[model samples]
Target: MGWLTMTRMAMGGHETPKAYLDAQLTYERKAEGDTPFQGLRVLKSVYSGSTYYAAAERYDENGKRIYVTAIICLVRWNPRASDGHIFGYKDMDEDMGPCEASCPRSVLALLTTTSHPFALDWRRRCYRMLALRERRIADGDLIRFPEPMKFTDGSEHREFRIRRDGQKTVLTLADGRGRFKISRLLERRFEIVREPKVAKTFFPAA
Candidate 1:
């Protein structure tokens, strides 16, 4: 997937799309030291509005998968608030939720800002709720909310669903508070091709 598509997948309220894109690029640049582009792979889950799953994988020189990390970005829309709060999680288990077992701190920081306490709190609550729901679903429990549920002082109530297509899983989000339309889901996977110059910069001593 292209950077524009990745930007769209990671986009959230409160920041212009361009701003979000810039931040994501900066994060990716900083991550190159630890995870070189040649070994990095990106996989996406279903995207509904501003909520989605993004996973990164690192492969060793022999093509063995060495590490995997996933992030679930949940954006809560509140009309009363100027901009919606964005939350992210790097610590999540597979089958416990839409997130993967590997959690990376850098991924989580992409969506969180320490300057906004309210947004930070919102992200924390949402992360806990999704983690709990993921566990319940994995235990063969059917999860369906009969009523719209409020999240973190937000004016809107939200609902989530998981759909399995062959080997692929797609997460769906619905706005139950009324008059809010969910965006169409878009999913994509991309491999980061390593550039020799980039690798040299990251490992100059090599």
Candidate 2:
């Protein structure tokens, strides 16, 4: 419904929240000793009319977590608009705080980043994980989230995932929970947004 559809593999009715996710995501398992939490994610599952990327994550006290990350690229939406852009991030931390978010108004006033990776523990995420394909931070200044900044592209960020009855290409990412954020550099300033995405699939060889 929102920019991204978030789903966490069930982990035993909240009791073993982390374990249940592991079982549900048998096809997307990560290596052992990756992180202290467990989570998974699938980005850009539906990239049609309302396009964006889907991201999700799950955490547990057993030191097991999974994060799913991917993008739901749009095939055709307002074709006349400029080519869409995807922000490249190396790592995200809780210290980033409620990065440029669009959700319940409570997020705007509450201490959202108090527990977030980018805002809380940045080093563990930014310096450790998160490999970026592109970096646009050089274009503009770092603008904090919640401060209204416009994205010119026609495709507004609204992420969703459609598993449907059975689809093969539905790729689930496999990795740890890395803090997520987005930055767009203009002529003299850069704008930052909050975009957290985790992987649901595990690449043992990777």
Indicate which candidate wins on TM-score.
Answer: 1
lDDT of each: 0.39, 0.29
TM-score of each prediction: 0.25, 0.20
> Residues 5-85, candidate 2, lDDT per residue (tens digit)?
122221224322223222333333454786433444322122113322223334344434433322122222221334322
lDDT of 1 by residue, 1-206 (tens): 11122222346542443234224422222336676544545543333445544454546656676655444444333333333333332222232343332233244433413434543454555555445434422211123444554545475433444445565544344332223222321211111222245344555675
Q: For model 1, what is the alpha-carbon lDDT of residue 206? A: 56
State the TM-score for model 2: 0.20
| lDDT at 92, model 2 | 26
* Number of clashes found in candidate 2: 58
- Model 2 RMSD in Å is 24.1
Candidate whose lDDT is highest: 1
